[model samples]
Target: MIGEQGDGESVGTSAGNKRCRNKQQAGKDVAVQGTNDSSIVSKCSMASLGYFNDGFLKGFVNKTTRRAPLINRGYYVRAKAVDYSLHCFLQKTASYSQRQILSLGAGFDSLYFRLKASGELENVIVYEVDFPDVVQRKATLIKNKQEFMELIGCMNEIKPAQMDNLYLCGLDYKLLGIDMTEIVDLDNLLMETGLNPACPTLLLSEVVLTYMRDASSSAVIHWAANRFSSAIFVVYEQIRPDDPFGQVMQQHFTHLNSTLHALTQFPGKEAQRKRFLSEGWEECHCIDMNEFYTGFIPEQEKRRIEMLEPFDEYEEWHLKCSHYLILSASKGDLKTCLSFHPPPDFHAIKLDTFDPLWICVSPCEIESENPLLRRFAHCSSLIAPNIVLISGGFGSRAGHHGRLRGATLMTKSGPVWKCSFVGNEGSIHLLTERMFHSMTSFCDSCCVIFGGRTSPLKPVTSVLLLKCEVGDGTISSISLSVKEIECIGTAPSPRWRHTATEVIYKGQRYLFIYGGRSPKEMVLNDWHFLNLEDYSWADIPVIGPTPESRHSHSACSWKGGVLIAGGLGATQIPLASVFHLRPTQSGFFWNRIEVTGSFIPRYSHTAHILDDKLFLLGGVTIYSDSIPEVTLIDLKTGQSLDYHINTNLVKWPVMLHNHSSVLLVKERQVLVVGGGGNCFSFGTHLNHQPVLLQLPEIK
Candidate 1:
């Protein structure tokens, strides 16, 4: 908790770290409106990306960067998104007179200066307004900063600390128009520069609207719209209300959580731009955070992109952010305004996940990861609830030698790595302990494993199970009680490289297997389920709509039969659609789903069930290696929702893929123990600092 200053008020209190109000503090605390009457803004550099590296979202950002937000995927994505878009926005017009560029709540931004330095705005004059502390901090950064000096120095060209040509007004817009003047005395500054409102382009607002009270934010738009004749406003921000990238920041800073202080109205970006329509700013176009990379970007650029965030939902950081949206508009007719902003310049980098988070590592976190585990070829394994389990053609590490080792067990207290030691140490199965296969959990402490090739050329049809135990302490180790159990049933066919799932029916546990490879054929479409209690595999007659025979599709437990979302083989192209089935109900009812909206068809994406909600995590999109975009589909409601999950988070944050996400001792933290990424919402591109660079970290 932050200690009160002599004035009885907390100093440097940020959105992420505010002292919870108690009787004593609440009675004594007098809310002090910012007294920095000077025209400037104060913004703390809050690290938002690290929040995505939580117990589930790991495997997306590098662990180092997630732990250190100042440098992760969040940082780079923000830099590139803003710089590229801004550059494109500015390079268009030849003149800049009436084109007013006002950045709302501008935080230590350098766009105005960068454009000025390039002489790109010879006819343009920029205006920035913010809190006093923020403006001062930016000034100080420019004066003393090294690597960032050049960037900040660009703004120093017009500074009285309040800005000359670029007037820097420092007043809270949450109150709206009370302290603001119709004119800020910037006429001389503009006269000296010979620029006014009759020219070309105008306006640049980046990641600024989230901090506003809707009315005030709208007022800003209204004010700018009225001030400029033909201005093309550019605004950028993360608009999700419950975004993991912004909400989790409450841990690091008080009052900053979406629940605490974010603007409540005009929530989504589309809604925001539409709000401008009422204010006379016509011809608005917006890009959802995800579309920025998907629709605008080429397939190749998307793969190399990655954003950052914290690792857990309850950890010190867990803010969800989506969209680096750019909105352009004008006061005149729609056609002219639309012509100002070019579409070709608006490319989205599809490879990056919206927010960054590390996979989980705690017991509670792991229990949420996977109740079932699987062992496949090499270290390669598959887990049901594809949302979090990871897969790999990349091979293995340590003793577990393949990719996607679903061989993990999460108890109420911690995660027990059982796949590494099938049957007990003394068991005959442990003698040649098999690795690399398929696995999922059934009942209290049982898991099933299957087919995995030792090498690219080899194939094996073997299934195994390791019993779990309710042990003591965080799951650092587990000693299996079952000795030997390499049980085989009259399974459909001997195959490797397939997906597996477990479901309960008529009070019995059944394992459903789908799509694998055989020595004779490269891919097979066989749906088989093994009864764990009877140790027998049965081919239930599956009826209803079905896709072509295929493998690698994410088969997860839905209503009954596993919901297969994506996979490869048929037509040699990956699948983008999803389907579900019933395991034991007469003929397995297979239902094909409508893969609509922004849902890209491909393989390698993960789908997991949480609170009965199916969340699809990162997977290969289309023909690219870029991770699958994450989405949420409520089984009870059948309503599909889109959310930003670190594409690499397919390993854990909300889910885990091929990797092992083991929950640690803490109920809040989960460890991505090993294997392909499989766990909860924790992991990192490193510490997930917020995209808004200047927001201070919550202490």
Candidate 2:
């Protein structure tokens, strides 16, 4: 498809990048250092990235044979998985008052940085963990490439009701000069980075996961699960079973002597995924990269295509085209899940509503007079009072250190936000996790957590009830209706970073699950019903061409059905379209609907639904940073509205994912909370600031 873009040329091969190969060689100096000690050997075989440098010539051959973007489908797979998983975790933790983030194997990754750039982070702390070499390399690269878009993170301007910073831990996985585990103990790492885990935290791993043994990787996740109030682990790696092109590419790589480190144990990608899930982490959802590219590329979109061309003599080698998919999963309702819906229009502004907002509290101003919003410079999320919600976001400190947190809640006093208050752990009950999916409140007292990141895992096969009792004018921490609910019939896997929406039929809460990762980290399109009263999960087969297994899509309930907005579909690329569904006694009835204008196909955006109306707010746009675009979907008339606002007018428009929110007292606004970006999804790179926004009057 790329070959025919501008010149309409065929997909031709090119000379492999000699620079990369040389760098790969340069990477070898640290390879297998001090091999004399077998204890060091036990420390880590994960050094395959260096080991693959076994034969320089072979590595070169592999490089020359493939193009630049040589279907590194495996990397994409892992990237998607990790991305989706983090998204899910942030979504699930939306209700938490404080949020913390950790990115393992954070090699040259920019998720956290971008969020901070957009001014969306609040009272959050992000700790980026990577090998000393990688950390140093990334630091240097970021500094050298400071002017580039990748380095531009959310400017820590807004101050929330609390104080936090984006923290970085540059440590060597090879501890004691060698402890082989590769992954540093998170607790120690956090301490080293000066971060706290008492709050909710999200963890991420990319191509790094496939490189380690399944057991080793799982150990990291298991440990993470027990660390914070709500923790999420996202992994990225390939999962293609029989990739023909991959074999040819590997053949050439073997010829070049490149470091085939990530490919060391697994013969192929899916094997790595399957193995990982079987090890301990639950398998949630999976997506094929090829399928992702095909659906989104549009047979055009050129420059992106050129990046993939093999540099070394394209004609001589046979190129195998591979696909990539992003799978996500999480430990509890923390993330790796799914949902559906549309945002509510701000036109219905009312008094006494909770309108969520995001901001970064400057460290210098953390102890300001109104710590509730002292340095609170700006915020994101649609400015409205109807159905309210905001997605997770990232922020940076005034000088670059801690991360931000996000939460959501409702009360008679009105919407309120508290960034990272590790001091008070009361923000865990609300979820400020959506920047895209629309939300619906079944009643004035109920706020249902559904379809979002925390994407996929083993579904509890039951509905969780908080039985919210808004006493004393404010909503109190909710207690679970049941200790645990098991499923005997069909159930959705535990998912993070997916969409979940409620279908209010016959005055009963029917939670529908779809488009999330599996325990093994693959995307899925299966729908299961959760009867709130019965407190059980039931497989209800849905009909129609199911949308691709996706995460980060916006879904809302209105008119007598559900509406889906644009979002990432676990494919390497995101999608911009709308889908609607009607729920019946049996299952879901799907129907595809396209809005007039193309909405940004993004993740970590917020959506809310009310009175047959859906509201959409800031999220990732063509520019990695979030854009302030307000959109509305009307289910009653089968139409949608798009509103392009001057974000500059709002001071700072943040994709405040995982931020917190509380309903404005006796108002129509829903207070959104805080969260940071992962793998650089938003504009900023860090999420350690706190601030709030009085969502503008949504018209």
Candidate 3:
């Protein structure tokens, strides 16, 4: 299935080498031909140049004319998509403790150098292969440029004789010259470069296979499939050649006299997926650039880049993007190594459709346990693995008003719940009796609780600290401490129903608090930060458009920012809006997320970050009924899915206000405990005890 130019030629190693050499030589030999290897390489260089121009990449300088804004944005999207795939592979293999990357037909690509500059290559080995002539040119350029050479940690000169194939001993970088169609040479060079087939590997082929014959390219794919025990092979190239836009694209390459040989044979997404599946790959997924740009890229980033230049080529841009596709094929432990599918194992609940078939874990069964008093508006923080410390809420028990206790939700065969009071037997003095406060774990053995109401009309300005020895499968003892943070300037008024999250900045931990109801019944949007080291408070001036003052919202740390969603706004109306507070040099800035998918606005819900997705469970909706819905938001793609729980597991709590959820990372589940209900005002619904909601498999 070779191209028309050499349909009858033998697909042997020598023939493949001849084909590669001829392709390279033709560029210099026939200047009149529009299509040549040098021209193809120039296009790649131009794409990279576009990325640099559009600010998608840095440290790269373009020596040629600037491209159109549309072209630059297109290239930026392409580079970003490929880079994301590369990052995903790296992240997946990180658990295995070893990883390697191999780029086939790599010509003038700067990925390895960029990663090295970012210090991401510390534990990774990178290898690049290209034609001998091309490799020679690149090696010579690197040798002459001190900056390029330094990237590989080279202190000495690179000898001209060793330019064809050599490894940088100190940098884990290997550059080689090999005809990829020649399987024996490819395998030999790979072995010489010290490739470990058992290690998780990422093999990238971007626009490289289109120049090879069908037999040749398929052979390369098959070789990688058979050799690497665990690997992900990614391909980026043009497809869909029959449509008008695709015809123009094909004609453009044809006019250059460089036929897209492999693309002609496999010219669509389905064809590409089938190609990998037939080549012994265990899994394959193919998506066009259009879908990737619209659905996969983060919306905030997309918005930021869209304003970089004036763009009006919408139709052409869509067509052009649709014509290019990214295909990934994986072999061996697809989920553990290189799964391209969205996490398949998710437990969720939606409101509108409460299907009966879905299932939730049974309420934990405990025998002869002194359970904590029925309470709402309490705070819970996981100070240690399998241990949760809950404190201070409105309750009916004699000692429940200002109580502090610890519970161990152990998982050996199944979940086991045990409760024990913390602090010395006679020492039970806390800063104040409070409810609707926030508790965040810090320093491994301690937790900090901030601002809550001691009564409906009074808020406490005190912060409490709880330190305990709960690890090692037993809780030997616990201690209570208090701190009064001092503010040099104006301090935020005491409030309840606020949100507090821990953030790490410049090697120091700080607590950021946002939005709540003041003691005067006034809603507030003020933000403050408490330095953990000094017990000092600082009022942060918020920049950009701020979210409306709200209370009973949920907030969690994500990508160095706090994601706040679903709360009662200033108008006393429940809000579905989501906002992110990002740290800046001047102050904190707010970004209101324009999220897609149907999201129900609710307050007093619990949100947890599991893997890369945000899970929102059980909340009071606008209608004042407990919403039995679970919403999952993918942090990277910003896609949301709402699923309804099968209430038959236990009678669903009528209300979910002031509840707490702790993520069990090892068990892949969340333990949701204690909330109020319409039927049972301020107490726990005994029938709806603590429940374990499963999470997706860890990536």
Candidate with the greatest lDDT versus the true structure: 3
Query: Where does the lowest 10-residue lDDT sum fall in candidate 3?
Result: 678-687
Q: Work out the TM-score per prediction.
A: 0.48, 0.40, 0.46
lDDT of each candidate versus the true structure: 0.44, 0.41, 0.65
Q: What's the ranking of the predictions by lDDT, best on top?
A: 3, 1, 2
Per residue, candidate 2 scores C-alpha lDDT tens digits across 1-699 of 222332122345333544444455445424422111221121112112221111211211112232122223323323343444555555666666667676665544445554555443454566665545544544444445544323344444423222222222222111111122434544554554445656666666654554434455555655665554445555544332222223333443344333334454554435545644564545444434433334333443423332343221111111122223344444444544431111121111211114423322212122222222211111222223322322222233344423223432222222233222221244443433222222334544444444333212232222222223333432243221212234345555655445566776656776665565445544556566676556467555677767776665566665556777766554334566667787667656788875553344544456666554666654433211123245556655545544443223222323343333333434344344443332211112222333333333434
Q: Per-residue lDDT of 205-273 in model 3, one digit per residue for the tens?
A: 887788776877888899899999889999988886753345456655666555677767797777888
Where is model 1 poorest over a 10-residue stretch in terms of lDDT?
689-698
Tell me the number of clashing residue pairs for each predicted model: 200, 267, 8
Provide C-alpha RMSD values for all models, in order. 14.4, 24.9, 24.5
Candidate 1 global TM-score: 0.48
Deviation (Å) of 654 in candidate 1: 9.9
**lDDT, model 1, position 497:** 53
What is the TM-score ranking, best to worst? 1, 3, 2
**What is the clash tally of candidate 2?**
267
